[model samples]
Target chain A: MKKERENWVDMAPDALLGYAVVVLALVCFMILLAIVVAGVRILTGMGAA
Target chain B: MWHRLTLEDVKVIGHYLGVLVLVSAIGLVPPLLVAVVFGEWHAASRYLLTSGIFLIAGSGLRFLRVQPGRLSRQQALAITGLAWLVLAFFAAIPLSMSGHYANYVDALFEAVSGLTTTGASVVQDLDHLSYADNMWRFMMHLMGGLGLIVVALSFGLFGKGSASLFTSEGRSEHVVPNVVQTTQFIGRITLAFIALSTTIVTTLCLVKGMEPARAFLQSLWVSISAFATAGFVPMSQNIMYYHSLAIECVLMVVMLLGSINFTLHAEILRGRIKTFFEDTEVRITAVWLIAIVMVFAASLAASRLMSDLPAMERRGLFMVVAAYSTTGFQNVTTSQITGSFASGMLIIAILMAVGGSAGSTAGGIKINRLAILGKSIVATLKETLAPDTARITISYQHIGRRPVTPDIVREATTVLILYGTTYIAGALVGIASGYDASQAIFESVAMASNGGITSGIVVPGMAWHLELFYLLEMWAGRLEFVTLLALMIQLVVSATPSSLAMRLHARRAQRRRS
Candidate 1:
């Protein structure tokens, strides 16, 4: 059985969707950022070494 | 009949397309003038032909039969979708005709990039190009940056259906009672600033190191790019080409200002500027810039990427603002950046996807939409804690409204859906084109957000299919995706399925009745 549909009448109509889109896009972005962070960590480590 | 963009409320979408073409045609003049100054008659002549053709076609369509009635809601979506395609096609012809651009799709892609104020360039070498070509490329940012419809309405007014035309272009605010007047205000303010900015920045650059002539030219291009939030640098090496941190800092300041609404700028200029600080877009964007930079800085700190906190903080913050604003300017090369730097850049990709304030030259989901979403999230969280009898309210000011509405939320959500789906779908296609996952994803975000920067996905003189994909992505990005999807849905619905089904079903019902 399906859950009751939330009344978006009181909610910001675009917020959920906007959040979702941003999150999805952010995930991809964050992954790239993590990789950069790791690489920088390694490079700086080697430099000091 | 449709007139050019006028009336804050009453015109159809078709008129916006017509207005953009007409405005782009008119905008071609300055570049043509520049071409004359530089002695490139061939470039000037080709541009003249292109502009002439665009004007005739646009004006002709503007005069087409438009009944004085409520425009179909679908027309707004249709016009937005078709406008980019139409502009790209006509705009490309001149560049190709001038013999610089080899492929029509490349022409289309560059034009799309220019008009969307996306800074992506398929062109590799810029050193040999004549002044006219360079100016023309820069002018695309100017026209796209300020919005052609707003530009047209500033110089001219349309009767009756003006409001529809304005709404079709997705304008919600009215700075004046009449949109034409508002357009004039915006243009006057913009032109004044452009003059001041160009003069000051050019002199400063000249004082520092650049040749006077080159500085002047760069100033003109940077002024347009800054105002439009477009990331185009006249030189091939981008902002880094100058190797001047001062210039980058100056350009970044302008780009940030450009990302905010002109109305906000006006408010600040008028000295009633507290409104500017209070703006949801402004505050959120500030927070976003700070938060993203901190996260990356922390990530770098953990990884020990850059030894100095102040230096990493400055570069990280700069990249954050640059990406989020969709200006795509960077003083650093892809080669020098680490994987952490790539992450920081990707964060910028997400920020670009979020874009700038609405009713402005900047593109993406915009800060207000995010603001509204933030409120909604708070409201959701509060519902669990509040008593059943508690009367609660949520409010935020947009262009003019004090309390954001459910309708606004719905519209913003629909646009987000369109933007998200397009980014992912484009990435999938790029992957299909044999690009790596990271490159495909990065290019997808870049193209879909109208953020021009890629991780080697876009090669110089690319294949036609890939060029077409980028062109379409840029167009859809400029319109925020839903408008394009709405147009496609209209066509698909009109051509084959539902109409045929309805007709056949009606016949069966009639036979049953008989």
Candidate 2:
């Protein structure tokens, strides 16, 4: 591999990195949702709200 | 003359698109829930049609023949660009059909604004708008904030396209291997925040003697808006309809948090709270927030525009966040403040241009860019003073160390360039419609940034061209400037100069057709 700066226009690497981060965030967001839903379910069951 | 895509790419594209559609289908939950709660047939009809389109599209993609591996770069870009278009068009249909807008395009503009979390609106009478429609707008903002694809990829309906999807969604760091899992992580944090924040805010509103039903819905809607960095209001007058600082404060805190990337929240959960302080993006954002408040407050007081001193200070701060974060939730109109045009409106315009943190729902040039631009300036100045042999490197530290290489500068510069070009283009059109260039520029930037503070430029029955221009700007801005550019460039390059690219592309198409 040449030790050189690649073309800045190369969107491949950046795009891939961005996707990975997005997926991570999406997954994290869902888990948070699941937890909330479960909590809501439990609270409703307990007649808390 | 772009080459028609090979089946492999199409399959990959479809796979990701399937995910986007699937996620969009689920977005109808809020609208349908609203319909059921309010018993509004018209609104229900909109949700049903919209959700049905998404569901059908998702199913079609699911059934499409798909490649098993990750998506090609071009394929990912294609999927990401088309996903927003596909979702926005369908989302608009319900609103258009419900008689909110005369046509689907106007409806779509509103839908895109909501989904992109831009919070700009074309709809004039929202309070009287059916509950279903109102809920649908809030839902769009919620999904748009985390990103439509983030929802899709989280459900594992889409895999490889996550990279392109996330980029379009404007995240600087993906920081995870499994795209679905990452989306889930963000989702989890968002849900917790939404539930907790909503309950507390709702309780407060309920305690404030707001009607219980209104309190619940308001809290729900506000939390979603705050978390997603979307500032849309179900009521016609927005937060002003409530006229409660308590509500505004809750919303402001949520919106502020919404402007911060969830990655930071993840770090806090992991007990690495100091990472936030160290983050160049957060630090710069904090500095920007403080400075803008002071400037705005000074301008407000000095001009004697504020009859009430305390009101001025509170509104000055809230208005600053509302604009700078690109949340667009307004308690005070642009006309409410009295200051030199240089201080109030001008400062707000620049702040709107600054936008919120990357990866959050807020749009604009982004704090990271400003941070990098700042670093680059300092580095250059230092280099001028240093010995010729001094080797040095300094990158903007947002979520992590992002090298401020010439490459990074170019990317950031390109983003700014695209933003300026779009703003000017829209302004030129606005000027053509007989508006002042400065007013046009301000409105263009506000819309493009999703900041949503208008100086009476965006309103009902405006020049169709200007309205359309702002709509397109909001759409392009939400994609964070690359996907649209990539799509155009890809189309031109892949299709032109050689008849062979398309010829071969056609062969693949023919094979697929067979």
Top-lDDT candidate index = 2
Model 2: DockQ against the native?
0.02
What lDDT, from 0 to 1, does candidate 1 have? 0.69
Evaluated on chain B only, what is the TM-score of candidate 1?
Answer: 0.88
Best by DockQ: 1
TM-score of 1: 0.82
C-alpha DockQ of every model: 0.03, 0.02
For model 1, the stretches where C-alpha displacement exceeds 4 angstroms are A1-49, B1-20, B59-72, B301-314, B337-340, B397-401, B497-514
> What TM-score would every model get versus the actual structure?
0.82, 0.84
Encode model 1's per-residue lDDT on A1-49: one tens digit a residue. Answer: 0221242222334434433343343344444544454455455553243
Q: Residue B193: error of model 2 in Å?
A: 1.4
Worst 10 residues of 1 chain B by lDDT: B1-10
Model 1 in CAPRI terms: which quality?
incorrect
lDDT of 2 by residue, A15-45 (tens): 3454345435434543343333334334334
**Candidate 2 off by > 4 Å:** A1-49, B1-4, B7-15, B61-63, B175-177, B334-343, B396-403, B493-514
- Model 1 residue B456 CA deviation in Å: 1.8
Among the numbered candidates, top TM-score falls to: 2
